[model samples]
Every structure is written in structure tokens, then in C-alpha cells.
Target chain A: MSRATELVLADYIVVALYFVLVLAIGTWFGKFTKSTADFFFAGRRFHWWVLAMSCVATLVGSYSFVQYSEVGFKYGFCAMTPYTNEWFVLPLFLFGWFPLMYYHRITSVPEYFHGRFNWQVRFVVTLILLVYLQGYVAVNLLTIGRIMKGVFGMPEVYGAALMALISGIYLHAGGQTSVLATDVFQGLLLLAAGIGVFLLGIAEVGGLAEFWAALPYHHRFPFARFNTPPYLHAVGNFWNDAMTATFAFYFINQGVLMRFLSARSVREGRKAMLFVVVVLMPVAAVAVSGAGWAGRAMVERGILPEDVDAGNIFVAVTGKVCGPGFQGLVLAAVVAALMSTLDTLITAVAAIGVNDVYRPVLPGRSDQHYLTVARIVAIVSAVLGISLIPVFQHYDTIYQALSDFLSTVAPPLAVPLALAMLWPRFHARAAIIAMVLGMILMITALNYPALVTPFAHGVDPSEGYSHMRSLFGLVTSLVIAVAATYLVPAAESAADRLTWFHIPRPRPARRRARHDIWHRRFRVQVVPGTDPRLHLHPETMKELDLQQGDVVYVCDARWWLGGLRSVHAVVGEPDDTLPRDTVRLSEEAVRRGYLKPRHRVILEYEEEPIDV
Target chain B: MGPWLPYVYVYGVGGCVFLASLVAGVRAGAIDLNRPADRRTLLALVAGLLLFATVHAIWIWAASQEPPVSDQAAVALTAETRA
Candidate 1:
């Protein structure tokens, strides 16, 4: 057989074996994924070693291996710049954005979103995730497509379908366990393959020593680009613009957040994130360098056909450098990288649809039923995602398209989420309104870039126009809600905020209207206490029992155990009463949210009032 | 080279069959084709993957590279021209 035919047979055997292995893994590990939480996040008790390895494996997906490698190989010796973008220390947890989702404190991070922002926002956000993750789901298929077509003349759809079959099946069955285990094993395989490429490429192109000596400049520093800015300024406007691309743009990334949220603790999530920072850096550097070296080696050797794209440097290196049987191993390893990411993307969107949207609409369902639906959703998503892969093949890199898509959607949700958690002043109504308006403005702004051209190049100009729109909505919504609150009497009682069913009837004023009337009228009495208007805690002062609409009075203030605690009262209600009337009656107070030490002090009145 | 190759041969046929099977399954109204696993099945899996990587892929890659890029004289002209 000719080389292409030999490669065809070899790739198929390995890919077939790869598929069977993943299926068997799903069969083995699927037993563990028995519940909603397990299906959602691997039961949050995933083994530490498994987590560390999985994280290492996960960072090597379709984009990192394919697009990132392409960039490195084509750029000559300067390919390390992209690796610099990978250096962040997992800021999701440090910023407290994930809360305890990965920490196992909460089952799903979006569950917190539901509590923080209300159900409508939860449904809308889930819709956005499902729409955006489609890019991620498709990119994996394309990565393997490049490998298959470049090496063996296999059609792109063949590779895509093969991926769809293998990953979709096993992921549908095994869920998180299959994903983690397969990722770790595949990660190690890919690493060895990578090292092979490096050694072989360098060996072919004059040894490493000669290669380094021949270069005009032997530059190895990752961050030297920072020292001398490209533009004619102190820090250079270029570096600042790129920082938005690499730094700020990364924080709201969907994939990284999903990975971090899978960890078992705040600290574990931190550990997992930090693991990527440590392991991925050198691996990435070497991989990119290896690709570049291969490009040079192939040209130096003159072995690549004239018809071949330089993007095939990796596949060419693998096919020519490795023996027939072992080419299968490289194929398997790369396919796994593609599969791991594709599976995660598909699984995430499915979980979003099943858990966030479908479950809420139909509140009554068995875990098994939801599991069944999750599998179905995964299958449909895979089909749709696979079909979309070929459409985006023209982009310079798959990740740019993915990133721009995320930049549009993630910014709209990120602002309202941040405000809900951090800003105690944010009301639920304001958050909902802001998010809705933000989504509309963002959709419009992203769809029409020409509208933003005047501000796009300015220093303070928002990086992505969608991000700018979200901020605009956040400000406008806050102002409207705060002003609206003042127009109506502040809800003086927490009961007032409660539903109409919870409101209390007026008590009888005639003490002897009937004998033992209280027993027949009401079973329980709610006592009114002094409202504490001033709460000074490191955390925010949240809504307690008393509202700003009630009659206000200083109930008591004293220093207890070296800490100041005070009780004030809403003495009266809106018979058009002021929030600060001691003479008013019938309002309740409850202390809530954060409290500082020695923060509340009561004033002592010296003499009787004029009414007394 | 043994059953793995012809099985792969059969797999190429089988893959077509599998794609055909997917069509058939779609016709059959089957949403997916996965099943649960047992202890024995799981162990077989771990062993297979280990063997595939350690023996098959590595042996092929390492043995093939033993000759190195030095074997190709055509590369010399391109290398010299670029230099």
C-alpha cells in the first residue's frame, strides 16, 4: 500500500480502538453518575489526583493543540507570546465569583445565580450558555478533521462523524468520570507524542545546539515584549489593547469557569486552577516550539508535498517521524484531546438545558428521567454541533471565533451577576431590569460595530462594545431602581415585601369586643421590635425584617462583649408616617447581613416628652 | 498486525456499518447507543488503553524515528537555500 493508504488503515485501527476504549470507560464509570449532582459536577467529590491530571489534560483540547500549535509553528521563534497569554492564576475563585460551587458547597454555580438574580435571569443565562458553547462543541470536530485529512486523506465529515460517534456515546453513558479518566490517560499519551515531535524535529534540522547557534537572536524570555512597547509610548497602546484580549477578556471565559467549578472546594478549585498555570506553561512552550521546529525541519528536509498546508506540520511530523503502528498512538492521543473538549462542551450545554430550563418548567421528575433527558440533549447537541463545524473552518484559529462569541454573551451576564453578589444596594428588580436591558443593548452593539468605531480606539473606550453596553445598562438600571424606591414608601416591614397571602389583619382596638376573641381570630401573634437601620459589617447589610417605610425609633444601643450592637424601631406605619417616628406603633425589626464590632450605640433621652 | 489490522479492516467496513448503524438507529428512533458497565468490562478497558499507548504507538514512533530526518537528502537543498 502507498503511504496515504498505509496511514488510512493505521489511523482507522487506532481510532477504532480509541472509540472502543472510551465506550468501555463510560460503561465502567457511568455507574457512579447516578444523581443530579453527580451528572451536573461529578458529585463534587472527584479524587484529587484525578482532578489534577484531568486539569492538565483538559488544557490540551482541540484549540490548544491545533490552533495554538499552528500559531507557534508559523511564527518562527517568537511563538512563545501566545503561551504568555496562558499565564493567569485562575482568578475565578480568588475573586469569589464561583463561590462554593467547586468547593462542593453548592451543587451548581448557576444555582447561586438563581438565588442571587431570580429565576428569569437563570433561564435566560442558561439559554445564552447553550447558544455560545456550540462553537466549542464544533471546534473539536474541526481539530480532528485537520489531522485526519492532512495525514490520511480522510474526509472532514468522516473525522467529525467518528468523533461524534465515539465521544457522544461514551460521554452520554459515563458522564464526568469517563471524561476525567480518559482525559488524564490521553494527556500523558499526547505529552509523549509531543516530546517525540520535539526530539525528532530538532534532530532532523541540525541538532538543537546548531539550531540555536544559527538563529540571528537567541531569545527565550517570555515577557520581553513588555519591556519595549511596540508603539511610541511608555507602556505602548498596543500592549494595553492586547491585555484586554489576553487578560480581562479571559476572566468571563465559559470553558475555564466550567473546569474550575468542577473542583471540590474553594481551595481545591484554587489548586486545580493553579495546576493549569504550572503544568500548561512549559508544556505549551515546548509544544509550540516543537511545531515551529517541525516546520523548519520539513522544509529543510524537503519532504512535505507542495500541495500540503503548513498547518499539517504537526501531522506531517507525526506521520513521517513515527512508525506505522505508533502513528496510531499519536492519532489516538490527538483525537482524545479533541474528544475531551468536545465532550465537555456538549455535556455543559445539555446540563444547562435539562437542569436550568426543563427542570424548572416541569418541577416534578425523577432523577432517572432527567438523566434520560440529559442523554438525549447531549445527543442532539452533538449532532447540531458537528454539523456546524465545517462552516467555521476558514478562521485563522478556531479560538478567536469562540472567544469573540463568548465576549459578546458573557459580558451581558457578568455585570448583573457581580452586582447581585457584591452590591447589597442592588435590588432584585434592578438586577433583572439591568440584565434584560444589557442583553438587548449588547446584542445591538455587537451586531452593529460601525456604531462604536469612534470610541473603539480610545484609551478608556470599552474593549468589546458588548461589555460597554452592559456597563451602561448597569448604571441606568441602578439609578432607576433607587429613584423608584424613594417614590414609594420604603417597605417598612419585611412582611410588606412578602406575598399578599402573608399579610396580617388589623388587630381589634376595643379590648372587650368579644370574650376570648384573640383565640378565634389568630393562632400566632407577630411581635414588633426596634429596627436596626445601621448595620456595619465587612459583608453587606442585607434585607432584614424591618423596611425603610416603617416608623423609626432608637430601641436600644449598647456595647456588649467589646462589640457594639444596637436595636432601633419602625414605630409607625404609613398612615403617611416618617421612617423615624418613635410615637408610631406596629412594625417589626430583625437584624441581618454583616455586623461590625461595637457598631450600634443607643442614645439616652434625658427628660420626658411633651406628650408624656 | 494480527486481528487488530483485519479487525480494523473489518472496522473500516464496520465503521461504514457503524455509520450505517447510526442511520439505522436513527431510523429505529434510538437516541443513543450506550449501555452500563460492569467491573470486568472496566478492567479490560484500563488494560487495553495502557497496552495501546505503551506498546503500539510508542514502538511505532520510536522505531520509525531511529532513521531520523537525516535519511531525506531532498531537504538539504531547501535547508541550504533558506540559510
Candidate 2:
């Protein structure tokens, strides 16, 4: 067989193994999923590491694989410009935004809006998310399909179909558990393949210094440059674009938020987010950029043919440099990356369809009934997603198109979401207006690029105008929503669960600490007087070293509110009724702290220095 | 005629509106500052603001290193130098 044929055979074997592994995992973990929560959220029992890795896999998709490579080819090191935008958005997401969802027990992002604003807000927000997610899934499928075509000379539709089938089977069998566990497995493969290809390609291109010297200085910089070709324009005016993208991904996107929902606690969600920011994102920046850099270097050196499409650079470089087996791993990695995201989108779409739409329409359905509907919805979503392959395929670069699409649709929803969570006074009517007005303004902006030229630069009259729309809409939405809120009547009890103050927090159970003054259990006696003050015997006070007036915690030995104690005043009263090693408890103190007379309570007193 | 003028005009009005809404929300009890989570979120907001300023400052400096020229201008300059 020829070299190309050999690589194809290797890809087949590797892809086959990948499918089997995914299936085996689904079969193994499928038994554990017993309810809608288990299927949709992995029963909220996922550890930080599982959630972290799964989240990483979801964020770094096949689109990133191809797009980062494409950017690296054109802009050299400046490809990281987009990745660095996440850093600015991370602190808020980790500390503020994600914790709200965790504390609110929100299964979906729109549910928060429902509780905060109204059903209309929830419905509108869900529509926006579903549209964006569908577009997102289509863009990813198109990119992965293109990769399969470029590398193995297969048809794009075949690649799309194969992925749709494999992802659907596993997701249908095991739901979120399968998606998450496989994501961990696939996430590892992604890092290895991404870094591996970069290393091999770097060696092929001579060295790192040689690669830098080959590219222009501007190409190496991460800041804005408007003068480059429309494709290579490293437009650094990222304030609005960054804000929109970062907020939408972490806060608005259900697929991403679902990963956080799977985490055990808000603390775990925070840690998982930190893992993405600190560990995965930095390495991914280098790995994805390396392939394109190598592509640029090799083309300049005449090692490979020039004039390859920018999007094809990643696959082209890896195919030429890596061995057949390594090529298979890269192919599997790309497929894994694609499936990881696809499964999440499919699951999220189904969840929104059932929970927000179907289940709500028909209340009191069995968990199994919803589960069946969820599976059916997943299949329908995948089919619908595959049908959109051609729509994204027409774009010059999938990344630019995806960015523009997200910018247009996501900002309208993100504005209301951010406001609803942070500013509780955000009116439901205002949210409705913002969603409508923002969409109108953004879509209108897209239609009329001439309106934006005075404000921005190099933006084509036809495309790349979404950023301008986002900036305009985000500001306008907040303003309009705030204004409308004042005009409207205030909600009687919106803050009970909607705002930060009203959300329930788990109070720590009281632990019993050693009463150092008396390590052993001292006898407790009831005082005859109804003074309600806990009196200690003068001899007992001397042994326990009680002062004239000191505060001590009287804890009921048995369960009182599951180990709650009450504070009481200690008086050193030499009582004849109270015997040695006996402390007197007033009936009132016993009733107040839920203690019984002679209930063997521990008298905890702060230490006072002995009289020297 | 400066490019920065439009940015300032648009963002300035937008910022004012956002601030107004925030104040209104607080007064209406829509925004509860007393909640622990809300207070923590305020701290995050402060940190995010600092981060945004710092990142943009760095980007502005880097952008200044190379003059703001169009892709056409750069291409024309390359052709001119070759001639």
C-alpha cells in the first residue's frame, strides 16, 4: 500500500478503538444513572478533577484545534491573543458567577433567569442559548469534517455522519456520565496529541528560534494590528469582544455551565475553573499555536507545498511530520475533541427541551418518561446539527464565522443574564425589552456595516461587525433594563431566592471542642433557685478554676440541634446542696439550651491564669 | 476625526446608564449587598475591573510599538521599498 493508504488504515484502527472505548465506558457507567439528575448532571457527585478535565475538553474543541492552527500560521505567536482574553474574565467567573448557579441549585443557566426575572425571560434566554449552541455544534462538526477530508481524503459528510453516530450512541446509552468520563479520557488524549504534534512539527521546522526569525515581528506580538489582511487582522480592541465571549462561555452557555453543575460544591466549581485558567489554557495556547507556526515555517522553507488553506494547516503539518501511529493519535484526538463538545451540546439541548419545554408542558411525568424524551431530543438535535454543516462550510474561515455568529446572538442574552444575577432590580419587562432591543440592534448593525465604520476600523461591510453590535447592545441592554425596572412595580419577594442574600448557604455543624478546664465529664446539679444562672460550687470552681463572672458554653451531651450549645453565666456560689465534682444547672438554662438536669453536660470555660 | 472619539462617546453614555441602573437596583432591593455571596461578588467585580485595566494597558503599549496602519498600507510600503 502507498503511504497515504497506510495512514488511512492506521486512522481506521485508531478510530475503531476510540469508538469501542467510548461504548465500553457508556455500558459500564450506564447502570449508575437512575434519574434525570443522574443522566443530566452525573448525580452531582463528580470530584473537582473529573469536572475540571471534562470542562477543559468541552472548552477546547475541534474548532480550537483547527482555528488556533490557522491563526498561528498567519499571526505567529499572536494566536494567543484570543486565549489571553479568558484570563481577564476568569476571576469573576470563579468567584462570583459560577457560585450563584451552584448555590441556586440551577440545572440550567436559563433557570436562574426564570427565578430572578420571569418565565418569559427564561423562555427567551433558553431560545438564545439553543440557537447559539446549535450554531456552535454545527461549526465544530464542519471543522472536524474538514480535518477528516484534508487528512484522509475522505468526504466531509462521511466524517460528519460518523461522528454524529458515535457521539449519539454513547450519549444515548449513558447520558452525562458517559459524556463526562469519556471527556476525561478524551481530554487526556487531546493534551497529548496537541502537545505531541507541536513538538514533532517544531523539530521538523529546525528549532523555536528559527521559527520566530522566519515570521514578521508584528506577527509575533499579541496586541492589535488592523493593517493585516481581513483574515490576519489581530484587532486588539478586545474590551467588548472579550467581555462578550468570556461572559457568554462561562455564564450563558449551558454546555459549559452544566460542567459546573456537575461539581459537588461551589468550592469545587471554583477549583475546576481555576484549573482551566491556570493549567489547561496556558498549555493549550502553545500546543494549538505550534502546528500553525510549523506550517508557516515549513512552507517558507519549501519543505511543504505552499498555498494550502489556513484552516488546513494544522492537519497538513501533522500528517507530514508525525509517523502513521502518531497521525492516528492526532486524528483520534481531533475526533475526541469534537465528540466531547458535541455530546455536551446534545445533552444540554435535550435538557432544555425537556425541562423547560416538554416536562413543563406535561407536568408530573415519570423520570423515565423524561429520560426517553431526552434521548429522543438528543438524536433530533444531532440530526439538526449535522444538517447545518453546509451553512458553516461556506465561510472562508470557520473561526471567524463562529466568532461573528456567537457575538451577534450571545451578547443579547448575556447582557440580561449578567444584569439579572448582579442587579436584582433588573425588571422582567426590562429583560424582555433588552433581549428584543439588543437582538434588533445587533442584527441591524450586522445588516448595516456603514453605521459602524465611523466607530471601528477594517470591519468588512459584510462581516466582522458583530463586535460593534455587542458593545452597543451590552451597554444599551443594561441601561434599558435598569430604566424599565424603575418604571415597573417592584417584585414583592424577588430577593428571597433571586439575589445573593436570599440563597441558602450550608451552615457548618457545631463540633464539640475539649473543655480544657475539665477534661473529664463533670457532674451537673440543678440549683433550687430559679435564678436561671449556672452556678458552680466554690470547691468545684477552685478545681475547674471558675472566675467570679465568666462566660461558659453548656453543651447537652446528647443531640441538641445536632450538637448546638448555649452560652451561660458562671457564678462561684458555695452551695451545700451541690456536692464535689458537681456543677449546678438552672432549669431555665436547661430549657433554653435544651439540656436536662443531671444530663452530664460539659461546662466549657476559658482558662484563667492561677494566682501566683 | 480621531478614532478614539466615537469609542469614548458611545462607551461613556453606556457606562452612565449602567451605573444608574445599578443604583436603582440597590434602592429597589433588587441588588442585596447584605448577602455574603453578593458581597463576595462585589470583590470579584473590583478585581475584574483591575484586570481589565491592566490587560488593556499592556495591549495599548504593544499596539503603539507598531504604527496603526491598514493591511493595504503595509502591503504598499513593502512594494515601494522593493521598487
Candidate whose TM-score is highest: 2
* TM-score for the B chain of model 2: 0.54
lDDT: worst 10-residue window of model 1 chain A: A603-612
Q: Compute the lDDT of residue A154 as modeled in candidate 2.
A: 81
RMSD of 1: 23.1
- In model 2, where do residues sit more than 4 Å from their true spots? A1-8, A138-158, A226-237, A300-302, A305-308, A386-405, A457-466, A488-496, A509-612, B1-83
Backbone clash pairs for candidate 2 read: A224-A236, A227-B70, A227-B71, A424-B30, A425-B30
Which digits, one per residue and each the tens of the lDDT, describe model 1 over residues A39-133?
A: 65664433245565666556665655555446444444334444433322122223235432332233333555665546655666666666677
DockQ of each: 0.01, 0.11
| lDDT computed for candidate 2 | 0.66
